[model samples]
Target: MTTTAPTATAHRSGRRFETARQVADAVLFEGYVLYPYRASAAKNRMRWQFGVLVPPAWAPAQGEHSLQRTEVLMEPRGAATLSLELRFLHAQRRTVQEAHADGTFTDTPALHLPDRVLVPWDEGTEERVELRVAVPELTEKEIVLPFNRPAREDTEPVLDDHGRTVGRLVRRTEEAEGVVRLHAEELEGPYRVLKLTAVVENTSPWTPDGPGTAREEALPRSLVAAHLLLGLTPGSFLSMTDPPEWARSAVAGCANLHTWPVLAGEDGRADVVLSSPIILEDHPAIAPESAGAMYDATEIDEILALRTAALTDEEKREARGTDPRAAAVVDLAETLPPEVLERLHGAVRSLRAGTGAAAAPQEPAPEALFTPDTPWWDPAGSAPAQPTPDRVLVDGTPVGPGSRVTLRPGLRRTDAQDLFLQGRTARVEEVLHDVDGGVHLAVTVEGDPGADIRREQGRFLYFQPDEVTATEEP
Candidate 1:
């Protein structure tokens, strides 16, 4: 029932920051199925050093708790390994006997004392998610991410045409932690020391429960500090053992949530750009990119210092009243500058601006939201969904959808290669279009054994002969 905050003289240690996971995010597939990924700005984040409650480079409490993301670049090109960074973030809510001694909260939330984190908790701050890969001139080699960054359970499925279970959708997910780099314009050579910032948010509205008042507000502020020290996006393949050689060894870090990125812009004040992809239907077929760049930063700390200079010790304050979370909001409001205040004031406006034109109306999910005819993120025939007219699926598994197929297949499967496997490799042998104008790939690959090789090679798999380069490979 007592606060676990570090002492005042130990302010620096209050957050107890830790590990900044740094690795290459390369991917390879085994068979002939095309890999899946969303390419754009977010993917290029090779440096995933941010977290919600932990600072970059902090060590875990004699345990294996850390933040991580597994990756595989599917489109545009293929890669061999998914090397990124890992740093532990907070885990399940611990039983803080004291915080709940008086029994004020339904559950006593853990305090993420990171020096900083990306608390993009306001209305539209959690607007996007994306993936990209940029080889610093230092390496001068292409980087790819194989292995699916485990998807989070946040956005919910809205109503379908008939108000039934329409395509599943997740809104500003609290589980989101994406990479953002201070993109370097130069191509090769002396690499720029990138400042990658991963953003996190609370999709659940600000209720009296959970992180109440004082604690609530401090959470976002902590996030601002957290992103600086570390990034928290559960990687693709944190599996204890690497998947059947087919699947590349996923970068190791946090194992639960999904996503990672390269971030930049923070000497306290820096420009920021938030981006993500549009995953339509359960079948992730298309990867449309979305980005919103803006020049925003914490108001010169000194400005708020004079006012909130005395409020720094509040993260440990007890939650009082029916809605203690409100107190934190008020504390943050007091320390906030005009700009952030404006962001607070126009939060709704900002949200509207952030959601690209494609954001579906908050009512019946529109079928036209994405390409009315295009397949979803999972492709056609995947489980939890079905192949619509003219559309099909292509995963490591043999042409099936919604199957628990593991792309890491050296083992035999009566199941289709498309159904199982975390990653895969397949080629577009021929383009097939039905009279209805649907698209499909008549693929080819060596049978059984090929499945094994395909998994390993899948992460780096890409279509060489799309049109002009339809038969090209350098």
Candidate 2:
């Protein structure tokens, strides 16, 4: 949906919105290029890995999707207004052309020049659409807003020191179209809760050439890294990942397809929500120590910087010519100071007593955990240097090695596989403690065929004390 102007509420929220934008920017370009940022790199060949909204005509054939739907709960104090900002990337083709002697330009995959090398690659251009609507209006009927971008082409002539036109760079963009549909429904709960549903669909009319059309061929007409930022005034949004006790039933009824919504912006502020294709917890923020975008979000900045710095001169030149952003990454790594590199090595966000551990008399500063004599990597260097205990207390019972317990993986910290282990009986193999003084019980499934083999190999599933209940031996 497109709004010609920003509403007053949007103006007031500019500061808070900037915080969300920083994180959204990271998601937008994630995997745009990988380490060793060269166009010829194998990993770089396959692009647009996240939140790709392809044209409807090609989605079914390609086994991809063309739409994202998000349902979130919001509590409005009075007449609440909602503002949405949809952001995505439009893939643009950049072709390197060499100027012929006879006043003609021919396309070439790579054009070599004395100063720098030019290579053909696909680049992304940012697209944003904003919409504002009153809560009452959405309850009446669904609102559909259509947006379109027309095809575009641009060329820049490459020059020589003698002021002669040597070659040219041509950039072309395909047309794209989409629609945003929004509506709201009131819940039956005692609180004034409204379930907001938003849908983003790719309405581009482009069709595939044939059944064999590859993903790269269809990406030109697709929306790359599409996501939404929702803002509410005089209202607050409930967390879908962790809802309040009263709204648990209503939250369970909400259906979110291909998109996960979580609280955004500053911590403890529920006025904004970020709907993303990648699953994330509430109030996600970009690491402060990061120098710039490396396009590989899962990789650490220190490792990427060191690897980028180790690239050969010729490789660096090619990477710089691949794309403008890639060039910035090369420059950042080459010029990064030692102190900044050290900062990227690590940062502790929080420290608390582990489950079933005694409360400390006083919380220790983060710096206190490190010392000149003992390195941070050494497990025994930190406070509570004793080895792991042979047993741990579960419901006031000393469940030591060989104790039997029923797994009850908590929803907050367990994965899908852990859910399947719920209520299964297991034998405690050992008790371990982490640097933070948290307790973990290693156990092997009772009936698994490989249980004996796993014990010999020292591999077992671990659970916190609170996630398991002691059971009497048969």
Top-lDDT structure, candidate number: 2
Candidate 2 structure quality by residue, lDDT tens digits, 105-166: 99987887664579999999999877888888778778777788889999999887888998
| Candidate 1 local lDDT, 47-101, one digit each (tens) | 1223333222221322211233322211111221111222222211112211233
Clashes per candidate (backbone, < 3 Å): 141, 0
Against the true structure, candidate 1 reaches a TM-score of: 0.18
Model 2 TM-score on a 0 to 1 scale: 0.76
Give all TM-scores, in the order shown: 0.18, 0.76
Candidate 1 — what's its lDDT?
0.25
Q: Score each candidate by Cα lDDT.
A: 0.25, 0.86
Q: Which stretches of candidate 1 lie over 4 Å from their true place?
A: 1-70, 74-217, 224-474
